[model samples]
Target: MNKAVFLDRDGVINEVLTDRVKFVNRSDQMYFFPGVAEAIRLFNQTFDYVFVVTNQGGVGLGFMKEAQLQAIHSDMITSLQKEGALIQEVVYCPHKPKSGCTCRKPNSKLIEDLARKYDVDVKSSYMVGDTDTDIIAGKKAGTKTVFIGKSDPLADAVYPDLLQAAHWIVDDAT
Candidate 1:
């Protein structure tokens, strides 16, 4: 079975707009955090699949159109690719928090679906994120959870950012 690493997009990959605490509405607003590209490159080399699983509720809230979100993601991918990082796939839940969507973070539908589709060993996989919901979903999906930034009791480990988390994952895997 293949091993995968699931990542949250907002704070994990790009800097979150502090004022809104939401998605980057414009491509120009997209700024990758320090060392994110290098970290993703490491993940690409270490895991069979490096997937981005994020909750993009800005689409549901009408804060940004889906096309705008796509543009931001496109730019982010382009930047990472230039740095030699290849993300296997990106799965996002574009539902409002109260939409009762099973695909949202804190719900395992997205991760579970991807695991089955990719033939992933969920128990051996890792989920890295910067939110409580992210950790909850990873735990529910049966993957080892790593929380970036804030502390979380549910996380298997916590790191300041993705680079540190990547280092831990790589070292632990061996």
Candidate 2:
């Protein structure tokens, strides 16, 4: 079985508003966090697969078009590729938060589905994100969790940012 790394797109791979009141509606709204591509490059080297699991309610809310989302993802993927990182897959829940979607974070459906589809070992894999919902999903999906934030949260490990988390993951994988 392969060991994979599931990453949260917003805040983990890109910058987001600190208030969490906004969403990416266009490619211009997306900005790769410093060292993000490099960190993903490290992840690509260490893990069998790197997946981006994200919640993108902007589309369902009519705030963003599906084409805009795809463009943003394309830009992100292309940028990462330029830095020697390749994301194996990008899975997102485009339904509104009130839609009762089973694929959203805090729900393990997306993570579970991907793990099964890819034949990945949950115990050896990890879910790395910047929110409690991400940690919860990882735990429910039976994977080790890494939180990117200041306080020591519910995750198995915590770091101030994804780059630091990447270092920890590399060390752990070794």
Candidate 2 backbone clash number: 0
Model 1 ranges off by over 4 Å: 19-22
lDDT of 1 by residue, 1-174 (tens): 999999999888888867644458888777788898888888888789999998989899999898888777777787789889988788889998889989999999999999999999999999999999999999999999999986888899999999999999888766
Compared to the true structure, candidate 2 yields what TM-score? Answer: 0.94
Q: lDDT of each prediction vs. the true structure?
A: 0.89, 0.88
Cα lDDT over the full model 2: 0.88
TM-score of each: 0.94, 0.94
